[model samples]
Target: MKEDSFLKNSVLLTASNITTGILGFIFSIYLSKLIGPVGIGLYGLVMPIYNLFICLMTAGIIAAISKVSAIYKVKRQYNNISKTIKSVASFNVIWSIAIGIMVFFLAPYISKYGIHDMRTVNAIRITCPAMVFIALSNILKGYFFGVSKIVVPSFIDILEKAMRIITITLLIIFFKANSITALVTLAYLSLAIGELQSLILLFIYYKNLSKKTPSSADKPERASQLLFNVLIIALPLCINGFLGNLFGTASTLLVPRRLASAGFDASTALGMIGKFTGMALTIVTFPMIVIMSINSLIVPDLSETISRRDYYNASLRIKKVMKIAFLLGLATTVVCNLIPTSLGQMFYSRDDLGAYIKIASLSAPIFFTSSTMFGILNGLNKQSIILRNSLIVSAIEIVCLYIFIGIPGVNIMGYGITLFISSSISLFINLREVQKHIYLNLSKSNIIIFTLLSILIFMILRGLTTNILNNFITIRNIALILITFSIFIILSFFGIEED
Candidate 1:
C-alpha cells in the first residue's frame, strides 16, 4: 500500500475516534449528573461484567471478520465474504438467545454478588439484546474496516451516539424521581437504542452493495471452511478478550463490597467507586481515544503486510507507530497529572476524583503502549501470547484485590493500587512480547532524544498550567497548544523524511 493509504486511513479513523470520544465523554458526564455519583458508581460496578458479556459474545468475531473479509475481498471471492457473514450472523443470534436467557434467569444472584444492587439484575436483563446486535454490528464494521470502507462505520458511530444522547436525556427527564432499578434499566435502554440504530445503518449499507454471481466451484469449500477457519482464528482472540476485560469487571465487583466491609455505607462506597472509575478515569482516557484510533488501522494493515512477508516495512511502521503512541501518552500523562486539581474543578467539581485522575494519569503511557503491542501480536497471529499476558496481569489484579481490597481496613485506595500494579505488570509483558519479535536497542542517542523530548513537552505543559494557570485553562490556550503540536508534527515528519 502507498503512504497515501496510511494517511487517508489514519485521518478517517482519527475523525471517527474524535466523534466517538466526544459522544462518550459527553454521555458519561451527563449520565453522572443524572444519577449522581453513587448511582454512577453502581452503573460502573456493573459495567465490567456487562462488558465481559459483550466480549464473550463478540470478541473473536471482530478480528475474524476483518481478517476474512479483507482476504476474501483481495482474492475477489465476494461469495466467501457473504458466506462468512451469514455463518457468523447465524451463530450470533443463537448465542445471544441462549446467553440472554441464562443471564435473565441468573440476574438476581449475579447482581447480589457482583454489585450489591438488586436493581442491576433488571439492567442486566435489559442489556441482553445488545449481545445479538453488538456481534452483528461488529461483523459489519469489521467487514467494512477490512475492505477500507470507513465512511459508513464512522457515520454509524456518530449516529449511534446521537441517538443514545437524545434517548438518555429524554429518559432522565421523565424518570428523574424513579427508582434505582428504573434508572439502571434506562441506562441499558440507551445502549439498546444505540445498537439498534447502528445495525439499521449497516443493514442498509449491506443491502446497497452490488451483487455478483458466485461460482459453484468455490461455494462448498467457502461455506464449509469459513466456520472452522473463523473459529480457529477467533479462539485465541476470544481468550485475550476475556482475560483483558476480566480485571475491569473484577475490580468493579470487588470495590463496592470491599468498601462496604471497611465501614463505608453501601451507597457511599458505590459513589466513591463511580467517582473514581466513571468520572475521573473517563476524563483521563481522552488521550487514549487517539491511541486506539491508531490501533484500529494498524491491525488489518499489519496483517496484510505480514501476509506479504514484508517484515522490514512492518517492523519500521510498528516502531514509528509505537513511538508516536508513546509520545502522545507521555504528554497526556504529564499534562493531566500537573493540572489534576484544575481539571477536576473545571470538569467535574470533585477534589477526590481529581486526585484519583492525577494518580491514574501516569499509567497512560503504559496503557497505550501495551494496547499497541496487543494489536501487533493479534496481527501476527500471536493470540496465545496476548491471552497469556492478559491472564497474568488479570490474575495479579484479582489476587491483589481479594487480599488487600477485602481486608478489614482497606478502602477505595486499594483499587487504585491494584490498577497501578496490574497496568505496570501488563506493560512489562507487552515489552517482553515485542522483544521476541524485534530487538529495540535503546542506545544513548535514543535515550537522549526521548528524554529531551519528554522534558520539552513537560516543561511547556507544566509552565502553562502552573505559571500561567488562568490562561492555561482558557479555550484559547487549548487551541494554541493543539496548533503548536500540529506544526511540530508536520515539521518532524518532513525532517524525518529528509533524513
Candidate 2:
C-alpha cells in the first residue's frame, strides 16, 4: 500500500458508506411504515439473537483477514493471501452453517423463553440463514480491507442494501403478508437474500482479482497454519465482540420484559420498545452513519501516525474528526430538539414519535462524539482497554436498565437515561486514555466559541423550523437541518478555525 492508502480508501469508503447508510435508514423508515411499530418490535427482538449468533460466528473474521492478508501482501506472497482467505472462508462455511442450524432449531426456545414472545419464533428462524450469509461476506470484506481494495466491498454493500429494500418490499407484496409475525419473518428473509447476493458478488470479485495478481513462488503455508494465522489475530477480537454483544443482547432483550414487569401488557411493552429502539434511536443516531465510517477507516491511519511518533499529526487528526463528530451531533441535536415533531412526522408519519425522539435526541452530541472513541482506542492499540471498558459499560447498562426500567415511573424513559450514562462513561474512559498518549492541545477558546455559536444557531433553527417554514413539514425539517449546519460550518471557518 502507498503512504496515501488512508486518503484514497477513506474517500472511496466515505462515499460508499454515506450512500449505504442513507439508504439503510431510508429502509428502516420504509419498514416502519410498512410493518408498524409492533412489527418492528418483533423484528427487533429477533435481531439481537441473530446478531449475537453472527458475532459469535464471524465477529473477528474481517479484522483477522485484513491483518494477515496485509502482512502477506507486503511480503509479495499473493498466494499466501489467497490461501489464507480460502482457509478462513472454508472454515466459516462449515462453522456458520452449523450455527445457522442451531439457531433454526433453537428459535422456538429463544422466542418463547428468552424474548417471552412466541410470535418471534418464525422471525428468529428466518434470521438464521442471514447469519450464515453475513459470516461468509465478512471474510470477503476483510480481505478487501486488508489489500486496500475497499471499493469492492464498498460497492457490494451498497448493492446489498438496495437489494434488501427491493427484496423485502417485493416479498411482502407478493405474499400479501399482513400479520406482524409473517412480516417480520419476511424482513429477516430479505436480509438473508441480500447477504447471499453480497457474498456471491464478493466471491466473483475475489476470483477475478486473484486471477490477475502476480503470485510469489515461495512455498505455500499449510491451510491449517494459514487459518491459524488469521485466527490468532481474530480470536481475541472475536471474544471481545462476543462478550460485548452478549451484554448488548441482554440489554436489548430486557427492555420489553422490564416494561411488561412494570405492568404494561406484552403488546404495549413491545410497542414502546419498538417506538424507542427501532424508530427513535435510529433517528437520533442518523449522523453516526457517516461519523462511524470516519471512525472505522481512520484506525489504521491513526495507528500509523502514532507508530511513527507523529503525535502532532495524530492529535490534529483527532481534533479535526472529533470536531466534525461534535458539530454534526450538535447540529442533529438542535434539529431534533427544536422540531422533534416535524422530524418524527416527516420521517415516520407518527405523531407519537415526538416524545421518544425528544428523549433520544438528547444523546446525539455526547453519543456521536463518544462513539468515535472506540476507533481512537483501536488506533492507540488499546484493544484490551476497549474490551475492559466495553464490558464495564455493558455491566453498567444492564444494572441501570434493571433498576430504572423496573420503576413504574421510569419505564421506557429508562432507556434514554441508560444510553446517556453508558455513552458518557465510555467517552470518559476512552478519551482519558487518548489524552495520555497524545496531547490533543484542544483550543478552549474555540470550544467556547463553537458552543456559543451553536446556541445562536439553535435559536435561528427554532424560528425557521417552528414558525416560518413550519407548514411544509418535509421542507421545514430538511431545509432547516441543512441550512443550520451550513451556517455553522461557514461561521466556524471564519470564527473558529482550529488550524
Best-matching candidate per TM-score: 2
Give one digit per residue, the lDDT tens place, for model 2 in 92-184.
999989988998898889887898889888888878888888898889888887788888788889999988889998999899999887888
Candidates' RMSD to native: 3.0, 2.3
> Which residue runs does candidate 2 get wrong by more than 4 Å?
1-5, 307-309, 488-499
- Please give, for residues 97-210, the per-residue lDDT of candidate 1 as tens digits: 788778778888988876667878878877778767887888888788777888888888988887798998787788784666677679888888789888988988876753
Q: Estimate each model's TM-score.
A: 0.91, 0.93
In order, the Cα lDDT scores of the candidates are 0.74, 0.82
Whole-model alpha-carbon lDDT for candidate 1: 0.74
